[model samples]
Target: MTSQTEIRVLEISPPESLDSPEAELFHGGVDVEFAIAKQERGYTDLCPSAEEVLVSLRSQKYYKKIRLAAVAGLAGAPRREDVLGWASIDLPRHDNLHLAEVHVAVRPECRGRGVGTALYSAAEELARDAGRTTILAWSDHRDAPSTRGDDDSGLEAEAILRPPTGIGGVPPDDAPTRFAVRNGFQLEQVGRHSVLPAPIDSEHNSALLSAAEQRANVPETYQLVTWKNRCPDEWLEQFAKLRQKMSTDAPMAGLEIEEEDWDGARIRDEEDRTLAFGRTSYVTAALHVQSGLLAAFTAIETVARSTEFAFQGDTLVIKGHRGNKLGQLVKAVNLARVLTENPGLKRIHTWNAAGNSYMLRVNLDQGYRPEDVEGEWQKRLQESG
Candidate 1:
């Protein structure tokens, strides 16, 4: 026989206790139903499964931010005792330690009974404990009405409702545009998702390479070379400078974000972390001859998990220097190398902001296309309340 306990907050530890059939039933079962309900109401594909949820919970990036919750009731009704929701809060901006990003989720069975409210309240308390004063939430709004085959808009509508939490204001339209207006969250930015299709013919690849070769001539004094061997201390210094300069020059809409400070210690730490994950299979760097300038570089790490094949992680490139088509040149060469080295690799995936047309053109010319679109929306909790 299982004992019953009161509903309260508890600090669960690693090696999650929710492993038994009863616990898995509570977690996975509720999640499956929640997804179907959301889908039926036109919420589309918004739910995350237990495995994915576990991954996010365990991720190094999110380990410090996540808060778990469960209801405590009778044994047979363990489903009623199951943790039906979760919230994660990111650390504050380095400059302003008082602000943080808050992510929230609630099980369908627990909705309307104030599960979101409880989860959000607990999140804010956690934030305050972490020395944060404000929370930002992100949600999406689709233009078309849900073709979910059900007219449960009313129930589906409550998904975005964020009542006054007293500690902070909820920005209106933090939910989708429609629900935001209906419930009170306001829209702060107009965002869109776009894709660059994969290149299909030799003509497309040739054009991309040509553009890059032409751009390479702009800085005639600089020589293009792939990054090899240990990165020299001087090279790292130049790379850091270029990184900051490009970040400051990149186009931003309305937001007054500043370039993040780069330091050698931090760079070393990141390098150590990446190496711990796996060995780097591909790295490309371009340097100037006369001034020893590190103008452009790109790195691709290949992950081989299954016997069938492999895929490419998104390639990172500094801005400003990209227009000369150096991005295309660097990426094309890197992709060709990967294909030649690893046979039977079918596809590659990458993502970019919808407004970034230049890189989109490069990827499209290289035979890449949009596989998926992830939306980003922000709401100011201080103002919304």
Candidate 2:
């Protein structure tokens, strides 16, 4: 039997030890009564599974700042013990500019007290200590407001009443939208998620190459080569430079996130992670030569397990003085190369912003079809606070 008393917040470091119970609880699903109890005691939301919690905790970005709450002294509670109810935030990687994403889980038993308020208070302190100026929280628009019919609903209601200062990604008709609106975050932009299926086998790839070659007007002076190793050092530099230029040049909404925002270290880290996950194969590069001058270049990585492998093109690019037809030629040759090497591949996946009609046309002509759209929701975090 537990007692109904004071709530306490504890900073649990390293997060790994909490995984088992967390996973068990999450998998078993929170009892509505337990959530209600927490809500009655003032807890707001539930934390995710221990595994996810651990990952967030262990990340170099947020480890030292993760905090949790133990609801103590609730009626019929386990003697001398409390249940974990909420998590605190301090994501250093985001710096002072980015607000921490707070996650809360209420034990059904402790709902309307002051557990959530306590947790949020601690989270705010943690953020301030970390030099953060804003708080970012999410909730579903369709879901009942945090305060709903509760005694302490006013506090819950106040947390989301301010305008959001910044927002990212598309808002589905789920928790995010509701949470933002209640908390004062305005919907900035609706975005979409896109996917490209795998590429076809070598036979189909060859046909695609032949067709593209027939249609493309790539100059004879340029030669398309597929390599099994890293691209030539100069080509690598050029590739990075061109990618930077293209990203800036591409039309999109909102602030332009600079190449510095996507530094080489981050790119290399991603590459390393991809290799560790076995998602990518050889890095492919295409160099356009004009009288021995490297006029244009492009690069791609082969994804073996991808659903897109069944298609004809993946990671296509054309850079520099290369004529418009060079894009098609490079894609065609690369597709042919990938097909010959991995005879079993079937489809290929790729993506372009909605505004990128030129690239879309090239892909369509090569037999790529429009798949589902991925939505990106944007919000002003400054206003929501």
lDDT string, candidate 2, 146-184, tens digits: 113222224433333322222122323444354344444
Full-model lDDT, candidate 1: 0.48
lDDT of 1 by residue, 323-351 (tens): 56667777776766665565545445454
Error of 1 at 303 (Å): 3.2
Worst 10 residues of 1 by lDDT: 162-171
The top-ranked prediction according to lDDT is 1
RMSD per prediction, one decimal? 8.4, 11.0
